[model samples]
Target chain A: MRGRRAFFGFLGKEVRHILRDWQTLLVLIGMPVAQVVLFGYAVRSDIRGINLAIVAPQPDAATASLASRFMDATDTYRVVASVADAASLEPQFRDGRVRQALMLPSGLAGALGRGEPVTIAVVTDGADPNTGSLMEASTLAIVRAWDAGRTGRRAGPRIDVETRMRFNPTLESVNLFVPGLIAYVLTIVSALMTAITIVREKEIGTMEMLLASPLRPYQIVLGKVAPYVALGFLDVVLVLVAARLIFGVPVRGSNALMLAESLLYILTALGMGIVISTSTSTQRVAMMAALAGTMLPTLLLSGFIFPVSAMPWPLQAASNVVPARWFVVITRGVMLKGAGLADLWRETLILAGFTAALFVVGIRRLAVRLA
Target chain B: MKAATREPAGVGSGAAHPATNVGAAVQARGLTKRFGSVLALDHVSFEVAPGELFGFIGPDGAGKTTLFRLLTSLYLPDEGESRVIGHDPATDMWALRRRLGYMPGRFSLYPDLTVIENLQFYASVFDTTVAAQMDTIEPIWRQLAPFAGRRAAALSGGMKQKLALCCALVHSPSILFLDEPTTGVDAVSRREFWDLLARLREGGMTMLVSTPYMDEASRCDRVALMQQGRILRIDRPSAVRAAFPRPLLAVTAAGEGAAVRIGLLAALREHPDAASVWPFGSTLHFTDRRAGPDPARLATELGEWLAARGIAATVRPISATIEDAFMWDMTSAEPAA
Candidate 1:
């Protein structure tokens, strides 16, 4: 009973510390909404309103119909100029007026009637490889459909391949980022914040007094991290609600399961934080370690923004050690695919293993007395 | 005090060795500690009887804080052993921690917490309530009550010390270890703090307090004069003063300005018979090399010697203070730099 009282007392002190620092509290509560909106609106993969230059040396019936087809294919393209040659589009491309240009050879409509092969080029500004490749692919698809329609032959020998995006139809990047945001926000809130709080005590000399007390090191750690667990959970909820209400991201799986998984990941992150605090003696070192050691890995190696399978084999092998990687997988599976435990048990088990390993390491390293 | 009734269990199981010393509040057999290449404490050994107000007097880097940490179980000794209240600090820290209160050298309370909240937090962590231990901390708490709602960081240095002391005492531990409780505090507050310690000692509490102020040594029942990780002397303040080995003189020139004082110190250092000369406050304390000289004869001789140098000075034989004894011991213990 006395031990419980002491633990509660320590917990209350930690909560008061969090509440009193209005700046940290603001960051804790406001960062999630800001990051979600920022990712959803600004960091989009879909393209819109791409300025296109149609350069046809001679305006023939075939060229005009092709230009009209490019314009009418989708809202993604806006024809800024229909010049006679590609040379006139250079100034437009340099001046930010055009991002992609379609060049057509001088031809009569008779060339197509005689079934002569024509060479067409889709020119794109490759300054940004992602947007450039996307524009090139979109232009090629439009030309293929236009050519197939012009041929008016549905009985041609062709091997048609169909592609469908699973879990996130229409390929909304917001659907992908929202689930990943939970992991990112929890890493910051749980690991970084907990490490800072613990190191602050060590910096200010309060850890000496706490160590001199009857409370064990484990008790002190649990009490210090208990408030962060609640705060991390609240952040997870805030991110989820914001994702649902603002981004329209769905929680296809059980909300209870998502929360349970989130709690486990928070504990794992907190364990990582405690381990960091044990190894570091100052708040600056702990903050740097948490950022470089946990946050960077969570963002870069966890498949949050980049797919893990696309990475080099070494990085793919190394990503297995990042706890957030498993968490991101579990969250994406639950939120998008509505995967049950049977489908996600592998990731969940890996996450639990990380939690166990990190916590055991953390507690064992937490010195009961100052060295 | 309530702690008296709750004598720590397993006291008999400790390696007390009652034959040598029974009921010693604190006992250490060559406690030593090192940090990297620096030896913070070197074979420091001492004993404090129960209800004794023991003080460790030293200047900065004297290992006072390190010794306190070792005794409080905040650190383990690199060599040797120590027992507090019949419990070994290294092996039996759990029960030892419950019965002792430690106020570290730095202000360890939460700076953002209100005064009362800090107090209550400490009280609860020890599994007690503030109201239950009110009687023990009432004297200090009464002064702190007016600022109960104020943040600890906003308190003056003296008030911060008082609040730290109140927090350390809130649990009514059987023994209290205070490390440099008065280093940065004002003179008036330092006196009040010592007086509070004196009152606690009268209530039969065992207190081990360390300070850099030599004047505060006179207030302790016994003081250990420490320097460079070693105890130079441990005795009653008066005994330490009485143990001064030289005939000391306080020399002051008539109408002496800072320039004249400097000249007088330089002149005295040149004197063949002058063993040691150091500026103490406004006057200079001088010790002679020869032994067994009549103080009056020495004073007259020194006065004549100064007169011959075209300086009017008063030379009076003065008794040694703890500071004087400390300077003597410190200078004699080390080789000339």
Candidate 2:
């Protein structure tokens, strides 16, 4: 008998085994989708509803209007404290009553009447840098708007420049996590399934039967991995659909390109699984190796939760070996940046090279073990 | 003459090969294997002719399963050469795999798949469907047909062995290697399983079976008595029994009680010339240090010796079996000497 028919027969049997076992089937689809939704909701980097403290040493009509303007304008800030002295700002901040404090010096209306510029101090908590920066920006916008209305004339040498955000104009964190989630989901599902499938055969004593057959080692590996490629892609589609429906994360680029890139990443992950399974004998060991060797590195180093650039130089260098890192970049580029293949050829090429390397090494190890 | 006249088929010897010799289904020369610090198989050598049902009979830890694994191409030997079905298992693994059927010692079939599904999968993996080879496995499958839908793990031990045999035979392999196929089976099933092997042998299927049950040695065409990673002797069962060099005696306690039997066994071991004594069922088998120890005189003296101890008993000269030979060989360093 030729190899192709036997290969397909083996693949069909594997698919049957997977489908017959309910626990394995559930884990295959459940873990990835849950992660996508969980990371999207719980790990967002957006801030809202900041508390404001206004310290007016001298109470006047200008300070009163300033306080009303902040409340009536946007939901970004609420006036939670009104103190008579600037010294009271310390306890307001220390007691968690306010995230930002505005200090208006004495005779603020008199200074404006004399045509002198008054310095209004704005101090914000710097514990959470993102929220702090956002508060500072909103505060300056409110102060400048009030001053512009009071003078009714242009400030010195003011230049009007328009800044526009492309792709994700709303800056929703889900848009970022959804693409990274695709890489993550495909990485874990493909690698884990591929790793455990071969080791399961080894554990059951079927591997000896397989090796004794005419099927080559490479044929056995390819057959075992072929079903998971399809399953992983199905998972990719499921995650993408869930993200779009639940979180409104848009896929602005070519959907075909995103799927194609995800498929490439899945192949890389499956290759990693083969490498893991060949080096280990039992399913327990293979699963541990897959989780520790592939999944954790993918989660930490792929810039999924933490940005890669903020990592130290040595860790940044080590992140290059992680396939998920490259895939994350490619997915984000295609989905969020609406980038084309031409723009992402470098990342795509790096992923292709890494996949080929892993596959070659894995197949070589499998062949050696079979021999 | 047996080796010279055996190759009428010329199946595995189309070419003049160094590793393969003509006529034999399997041939090994000085095969040695090791597992870390333990020497599993040490300098073992043997041959199985075409259509010969060869048995490796020994206690546990004898190199039977290790030799089986090596010959089946599931493992490589550290220090020797072997040819299975006309090719070196080390180099021609795939070529040899096409012609071999291997059932490992453990219950290694897929626990998740049903009995029938397991059979089908094994067949399909060898590029042959179960239906195509139905005639070959019909006997085993018929017994397993009633529990076809049950998972392999849920089957009884006897049924699991039958299912494993069916899967191994479903590919219609030319040579079969069964490692301890009857180890955990019931006595009736074990007998029936050997009957199946005999039938397969009659159909001209070469088989190598291993077992720890010494009684099953008489069922094989030839047997290799193995102990401690070495072959003590390899010959026909009758030859092995005849080669036991000492005079044997059987002593039975007249009173049918466990206490009397135990006292008899202990009393016989105290005899001056008794080299070894082991209880077989209700009777005790004893061997003398000398080859021709005057059977009647020894029996009377042993009877008198037990009578003096107030343990009534009867003693008689008896023929030795493979188990007796094995026991004698295990107790004494030299059997043939």
Best candidate, TM-score-wise? Answer: 1
Which residue pairs show backbone clashes in model 2?
Answer: none
User: TM-score of model 2 relative to the true fold?
Assistant: 0.87
TM-scores of chain B, in order: 0.92, 0.90
Measured with C-alpha atoms, the lDDT of residue A159 in candidate 1 is 21
User: Which candidate number maximizes lDDT?
Assistant: 1
lDDT of 2 by residue, B1-337 (tens): 2222122112232122222357788898788999999999977877778888888988898889889888988788999898888889888887888778988888878888899888887887788888999889988888999999999989988889999899889889999999999999999999989988988998899999999998999999887877777776677788778878888899988998888788788888888888899998888999987777688888888888888889888899888999998876665533322
lDDT of 1 by residue, A1-371 (tens): 88998998899899899999989899999999999999999887666888999988889988888899878846688998899978877888897899999888777355676666677788998888767765766676667666778854333213231231344534567888888889999999999998899889999999999888898888999999999999999999999999899988999999999999999999999999999999999999999999999999999999998778668999999999999999999999999999889999999999999999999999999989987
List the lowest-lDDT window of 10 residues for candidate 2 chain B.
B1-10
**Model 2 alpha-carbon drift over 4 Å, by segment:** A42-45, A53-76, A82-87, A100-171, A367-371, B1-21, B254-262, B334-337
**Which stretches in model 1 have alpha-carbon errors above 4 Å?**
A52-74, A79-125, A133-164, B1-20
Task: Indicate the docking level reached by candidate 2.
Answer: acceptable
TM-score: model 1 vs. ground truth: 0.88
Q: Write the per-residue lDDT of candidate 1 for residues B189-233, one digit (tens) a residue.
A: 999888888888889989999998999999998888888888777
lDDT accuracy of residue B255 in candidate 1: 73
TM-score of each model, in listed order: 0.88, 0.87
Count of steric clashes across candidates, in order:
0, 0
